[model samples]
Target: MAGTTGGAAATAPGKKGETPAATRSGALKRLPLALLVFFAALLYSQIQPPPSKVPGAPGGPPVTAPRTRLRDGRHLAYLESGVPKEEARYKIIFVHGFDCCRYDVLNVSQGLLQELGIYLLSFDRPGYAESDAHPARTEKSIALDIAELADNLQLGPKFHLIGFSMGGEIMWSCLKYIPHRLAGVAILAPVGNYWWSGFPADVVEEAWYVQFPQDQRAVWVAHHLPWLTHWWNTQNLFHSSSVKGKNPIILSKEDTALSQKFLDRTYKEQVRQLGEHDSLHRDMMVGFGKWGWSPLEMENPFAGAGDEVKVHLWHGVEDLFVPVQLSRYISKKLPWVIYHELPTAGHLFPAADGMPDVIVRSLLLGDE
Candidate 1:
């Protein structure tokens, strides 16, 4: 200003001897604020809340079985419903599908119990909600776990098993390793072994999840880099088609509503716990990997044992997640399986109105 220069002369770096000390002082004054911001970000990253629950989520009624400590030093959580009377027709164990917990089958159990008076025991698979993770779990190991669970609950030598979707793999394992402990097996829209040949090319192409980009990526990760599968699941970076294929095969409006209800219930249960991704990843690995045994290689437990230990396979011809072709392949390999292919059903056929009654009547009560 004395030389009539612009205002920059006063603030310009090193112009009027604005020293490094001034800059240092300025940074020092900001140190506390900087530290506060850094720590705030660190805490936010570490303590982020879980995703919000889905609106109108169909939560199951209160759980009954409660958690029990298994002999292997792991916790097994389960829900028991229906009449537990000694004269109950069948003590059925319900194994839920992929990405689902024990509560997924509650509605089905309620329907069966109300109509047929069957006893139902639905347990969370290892690595699922409230149950301890089994990092090294194999199909055979799961079968043994079921046997131990039965023994712990004192369900006697044999009990009926109902496996839905991915749960069917465990049912197959039981057929292979613990046939003597099973009264019967029922699989609904079960995923087939990847190594099993005869998947129709057209069917595979039509299944939406098979072609969906996210699902393809997830499946690739699940097969090759299984350790990343859990992260992938937790990120919600995948999609599985809820409908049949490109088209809808639902029978009525009520069936459609019921399917939505089941899907909502399943979604709520999946996010109810922290380690659901672990179960999901484990399921994918076991399904895509070498199943401990094959139905083709194993002897039919009901070969000469009458209808007590029969295997029943129920699938919708339009199933997208597990194509009916897979079920057909299984039936061909194990010709003794009682296979039913509903023409107008889809992947959610089990949850369709009145289907639960049909399943219970046919599988547990031995009705035609």
Candidate 2:
């Protein structure tokens, strides 16, 4: 009887079954909560202002330079600093790194500027702030834009270039495309090419983020959902104190204070424009993606002119973001790069006390 079913079993409800009404009731009970959450998220998104749109917000410094039209009709915003009359001496055009704008280099000490006797220029690369997005922008295309900007500003036939962090990629492109236009090139804590071989054994070991997905989630988001990347950066503003915790040894008291001042002025200002997100997205995409050219393909432009264009590579030995070994590899590959590996320094050292002066002076004023 227990094992077998009677004729009545055929008409009975299936074993362990709940009535259809009960299932429908359960879904109905959960519906209100789901709707509540949906509407809450919708409201938050609607009311929350974009990071760039907020007034007196924390980001980069405000745009102080006039926006000029390039040959392609896109607007290129730039800041010109230093003695305008000193233009006869080689000009310095600064290329900013991730999350930075033209204002990044504006904080260089007044004493240093007066001492160097060099004209300084910095501009928003395509898409970072006020600069128009170039959807087809490659590293070489960016070089072309710089060439156009150089011509527009009448910066002579050549100028010294300083590329910081991710900006180094564009600097590499400049070397390939417009070497003749450069008086010298300097890279500070530059991002290394992924395709380059002979990476130090410790590179993979030291670069824990490369192995850990959670650590690199922000970068992943920047590559996939740039809007979210902008929102995250906006919500979590940069503070020099943040660096203090992570890099205790790298920043001295003077360096920390200078860094704080620099961040206070430039961080919020860099992201004030709506186009910043687009620019940041493009930078990440082009930086990690195929560069469309190789550093090996480039020849020293000054070689033919009977002079060697100075190449300076400065990297902090303790840099966790970009391994120092990469710089070592790059120096070896290029052979001509004058590499400076600071033992007590980290990635942020370039922006630290006396370092900016050192960088500008070493290139402009020479070792003297």
Candidate 3:
């Protein structure tokens, strides 16, 4: 009767299916293959890097260099990347940040100007890279070096200047001193926010002395920039989040999700490395007080300068080091300047994903 009713579940003892060992064996055999495919995809993605140039790039004309010297006898390193002596309307000078080599900004300027037929020159700041450090580094002294570099390079009567981070402060000094010489200027993530801070300059400056009383001028930055970059990053990010304007483009769902994950992971890793340095307290004080406030003090100089100097400013609304609030402050004060509040960028540009394009376009095409 059972045989006639015939259900496959009616198995005998010897044929009671294969043992669990067989199931375990099958999974173990396939595990290596699955991992191999996963890693292969990752390797393939890395092999093909992003395109090296912007869309519709008409490469710049050939460049030439003529021998020149600085008055201070300091041998400055520079590369001339456009047809020199060709009376171009604008000769652009790029100024880098503290402790940064010329190579840092060169990597950016070279690409843009090389493809756009624009004149660009970048050099190491004193105490950095190949350029000779000043016996004493001060706002005024550094400005002199830059002005001299421009003269030596014989860029042009009309020139544009772009500066980033600490370089922004230096750029301001140069702009103020050489008011008649510049045709335009652009500041990226300029760091002097002391005026906007709740604390007074005297209080802020005094705090710096306490934190780094003996180490004011000596070189003291986090050896590992990627790790110690958080303090700076945080300031920019907090500022970026606060920007309000006419219908800023919102991130798509996929980008929003992916960005959140990346930000969380990056922030954690950066914070974890923070314990290695004990200099944060002093660094912040000197940075916010002295280094940061210098530019705001010079803002008044732009008032009476002749010539229509077009100024363009772009900063991530999410920037942590230099907040968007600072950008907003400058935009309000300098009526001639146009500010673009980027919705999804951090402090690192020209190297970060979306920022390099915004920066280059802003510098090249104005605020539109």
Per-residue lDDT for 264 in model 1?
56
1 versus 3: better lDDT goes to? 1
Alpha-carbon lDDT of model 1: 0.68
* Residue-wise C-alpha lDDT for candidate 1, range 1-368, written one tens digit per residue: 56656545555654365665686787889999999999988756543433322212344223334776777887677888888846567788889887777877735646558667788888888877666677778878888888888888888888989989888767888887888888888888887665534445554454534434655665666667665655555553345322211223423443455566755563464434544444666788777665545565665777788756668889877654666776776687678898888886766778766777788778866775
Ranking by TM-score: 1, 2, 3
User: How much does each candidate deviate from the true structure in C-alpha RMSD?
Assistant: 8.5, 8.0, 18.2
What TM-score would you give candidate 3 relative to the actual structure? 0.53
Better structure of 2 and 3 per TM-score: 2
> What is candidate 2's TM-score against the reference?
0.70
**Model 3 accuracy (lDDT, Cα):** 0.51
How well does candidate 2 score on lDDT at residue 264? 67
Clash number for every model?
0, 11, 14
Worst 10 residues of 2 by lDDT: 238-247
Worst 10 residues of 3 by lDDT: 239-248
Cα lDDT of model 2 by residue, 1-368, tens digit? 74456534543543345555666787889999999999989857843434433212355334455877887877788888887834445588999887777878734677767766668899987766666667777778888898889888888888889998888757788888888788898888887655434455566355534323432554545445544544544453432212212343434443454457555663464553655445665566566555455664455556665545788888877665566766776777776677888886766777766778888777765662
What would the per-residue lDDT of candidate 3 be over residues 67-92, giving only the tens digit for each residue?
23567665555655553537444477
Task: Tell me each candidate's TM-score.
Answer: 0.71, 0.70, 0.53
